[model samples]
Target: MQIIMSGLIMGCIYGLAALGLVLIYKTTMVVNFAQGEMAMLTTFISFGLLTKYNFSYFVSFTGALIVSLILGAVIYAVFMNRVQAADHLNQIVITLGLFLIINGVAGLLWGHQPESFPTPFSDKVIPIGSALITRNDIFIFIFTLLLMGVLYVLFNFTKIGLAMRASAQDLTASRLMGIKVPLVFMSTWAIGTVLGSVAGMMTAPLTFLSPTMMFDILIMAFASAVLGGFVYMPGVIIGGLIIGVFGNVVSYYYSPEMKVVYTFLLIIIILYIRPQGIFGGKQTVKKV
Candidate 1:
C-alpha cells in the first residue's frame, strides 16, 4: 500500500505533465519540449508571489495561472505559429531553444538553490491497511480525477472543445467550416500551458522548488506519453500512473538511483514488443 500510494502521488504529477504535452501535440502537431520549463517558470512565479510579494496563496496561484495563459498564447502567436509549417526538426529545435531560454531565465531570477514549497493540504497522515499516506497524496489523486472529468466534459460537450477537436482532426476542414483555426490553436496552447503550470505547482509541494526542478519530471512525462501513446489523452495519463507505480516498486525492491534507468528500460522493452505504445496504433475519431 505504501509503495502504491507513493507511486500514485508521483504518477498523478507525471500524468498532469504528460497531459499538457499530449494536449498541444494533438492540436498543434508540435511537441512542446519546453513544457516542463514552462511549468517550472510558472511555479517560480507562484513562489515569488507567495514569498517575495507576500501575496495570499490563492492570489499567487491565480496570478501564476494567468501568467501561464499569456505565456502560452504569446508563444503560440509569436513562435509556434510561424513554425507550424516548418519541418518537425525545426519545430523540435525551436521548443528546445525555448527550453534553454526559459531555464536560463528561471535560474537568473530564482537561482539554483532549492526552497521548500508551501503545501496546501494539512500534514496529517492517514493509514490504510497499515500503510500511511498524507492528505496531499489523497488530494493529488482526487484533484487529478476532477481535472480529468472537467477535461472530458470540455472535450466532449462544449463548442470550443468541438472546434478544437475539429482543428486537430482536420485543420483545413476546420477553416472551411468557418472555425477560426488560429484562435482555436492559440487557445489550445494557452490551455496546454495552463495544464503544465498546474502540474508544476502540484509538483513543487511534493518535492522542492528550483530552476532545474522539472528536469526529472519532464523525462518521466515523456516516458508516460510514450508508454500510453501520444495522441490518446487518457492513455498517456494511465501510462503516467504505470510509470509512477513501476518506478516506485522498482526503487523499493532494487536501487533508487537506477529507478529512472529501469523505467526507460521497461518502456523500451514494451515498445519493442508494441512499437505503437500501449495505447498507440488506434486513433479514435468522433464524427458529428
Candidate 2:
C-alpha cells in the first residue's frame, strides 16, 4: 500500500507534465523537446520571486505560470510561426535548439547548485492503515487532479476549446470556418507551458531545485505520453499511473538502478505489441 500510494502521487506529477506535452503535440503536431527545460526555467524564476524578492507562494506561483505563458507565445510567434510551413524535422530541430539554450541559460543563472524548494504544504504525516503518507503528497495529488479537471472543462465545454479542437483536427478547414489558426496555435503553446510550469512547481519540492532537475522526469513523461497514445488526453493520465506503479514495484523487488531500464523495456514491448498504444485509436493513412 505504501509503494502503491507513493506511485500514484508520483504518477500525478508525471501525468501533469505529460499533459503539457500532449497539448502541444495535439495542436501543433510538434513534439516540444524543450518542454522540461522551459518548465525548469520558469521554476527558477518562481524560486527567485519567492526567496530573493520575498513574495508570497501564491504570487510567485501565479507569476511564474504567467511568465511561462508569455514565453510560450513568444517562442511560437517569433520562431515557430516563421517555420510553420517547414517540414516536421525542422520544427523538431528548433525545439531541440531551445532545449540546449534554455538548459545552458538556467545553469549559468542558477550556478548549477541544487537547493531545497520551499512549499506551502505542511510536513505532517498521516497514517492510513499501515501506510504513512506526507501531507505534501496529498496536496500534490489534489492539486494535480484539480488542474486536470479545469483542463477537461475548458476542452469539453468552452467555445475556445471547440476552436482548439477544430484547429487540431484540420488547420485549413478550421481557418475556412473562421477560426484564427495562428491564435489557436499560440494559445495552445501558452496553455501547454502553463501546465508544464505547474508540474515544475509541484516537482521542485520533492526533488531539489537544479538546472537539470527535470531531465529524468521528462524522460518518464515522454514514456507516459507514448504509452497513453500521444494524441489522446485520458490515455496520458492512465499511462502515467501505469508507469509510476511499474517503476515503484520494480524498484521494490529489483535493483533501483535497473528500474529505469526495465521501464523503458516495458514501454518498447508494449509499443511493439500495440503500435497505436493501449487506448489510442487506429491510425488512418491518407493516400494523396
Candidate 3:
C-alpha cells in the first residue's frame, strides 16, 4: 500500500502532464516534443518570481500560468499554426527543435544547477498503516484531481470546450460551420500549456527546479498517454496511475535505474498488442 500510495501520487502527476500532451494532439494532431521543456520553463519562471522578486507562491504561480497561456498561443500563432497543414514529419521536427531551443535557453538563463522550489506543504507526513502520506503527496494528489475535474467541466460544459471538440472531430466541417478553427486550436494550445505549467510547478518541489526537471515526468507522461490510449482523455489518467504503481513496484523490487527501461518495455508490449492504445478508438489520420 505504501508503494501504491506513493506511485498513485506520481501517476497523478504523469497523468496531468500527459493530459496536456493529449489535448494538443487531439486538437492539432501535433505531438509536442517540447511539452516538457515548456513546462520546465514555466516552473523556472515561477521560481525566479518567488525567489528573486519575493513574490508569494500563489501570485508567482498564477503569473507563471498566465505566461504559459500566452506562450502557448503565441507559439501556435507564430510558428505552429503556419505549419498546421504541413507534413507530420515537419510538425515533429518543429516541436523537437522547440524542445532543444527551450531547454538550451533555460540552461543559459538558469544555468545547469538545480534549484530548490518552495512548496505550500511542509516536509511532514502522517502514517496510515504501512503507508506514509506526506503533505506534499496529499497536495499533489488533491490538486491534480481538482484540476482534472476542472478540465472535465471545461471539455464537457464550456462553449470553448464544445468548439474545441467539434474542431477536433472535423476541422473542415467546424470551419464551414462558423466555428473559429484557428481560435479553437490556439485555445487548445493555450490550455494545454496551462496544464503542463501546473504539473511542472507542482512537481518541481519534489524533483527540484532545473532545465531538465520535466524529463522523467515527460517520459512517464508519454507512457501514460500511450498506455491509456493516447487520445482517450479519461483512460489516460488511469493509465498514469497504473504506470505509477508498476514503475514504483519495479523501482522498489529491482532498481531505480531500471524503472525507465521497464516502462519502455511495457509500452512496447502494449503497442505490439494494441496499436490503437488500450482506451483509444480506431486509429485514423485526420488533417489538422
TM-score to native of every candidate shown:
0.96, 0.97, 0.96
lDDT of 2 by residue, 55-115 (tens): 9999999999999999999999988898888999999999999999999998888889899
> What value of lDDT does candidate 1 attain over all alpha carbons?
0.92
| Candidates sorted by lDDT, best first | 1, 3, 2
Task: Report the lDDT tens digits of candidate 3 across residue range 1-288.
Answer: 999998998899999999999999998999998999999999999998999999998899999999999999999999899899999999999999999999999999999998889987678889989899988898888888898899999989999999999998887789889999989999999999998998899889877888989999999999999999988998999999999999999999999999999988998998899887889878666555
Model 1 residue 252 lDDT?
94
Ranking by TM-score: 2, 3, 1
lDDT, candidates in the order shown: 0.92, 0.91, 0.92
lDDT tens digits, residue span 1-288, model 1: 889889988999999999999999999899999999999999999998999999987799999999999999999999999989899999999999999999999889888999999977789999989689988788789989998998999999999899999998888899999999889989999999998898999899988999888999999999999999988999999999999999999999999999999999999999999988998886666778
lDDT value for candidate 2? 0.91
Relative to the unseen true structure, what is the Cα RMSD of model 2? 1.1
Q: What is the Cα root-mean-square deviation between model 3 and the actual structure?
A: 1.6
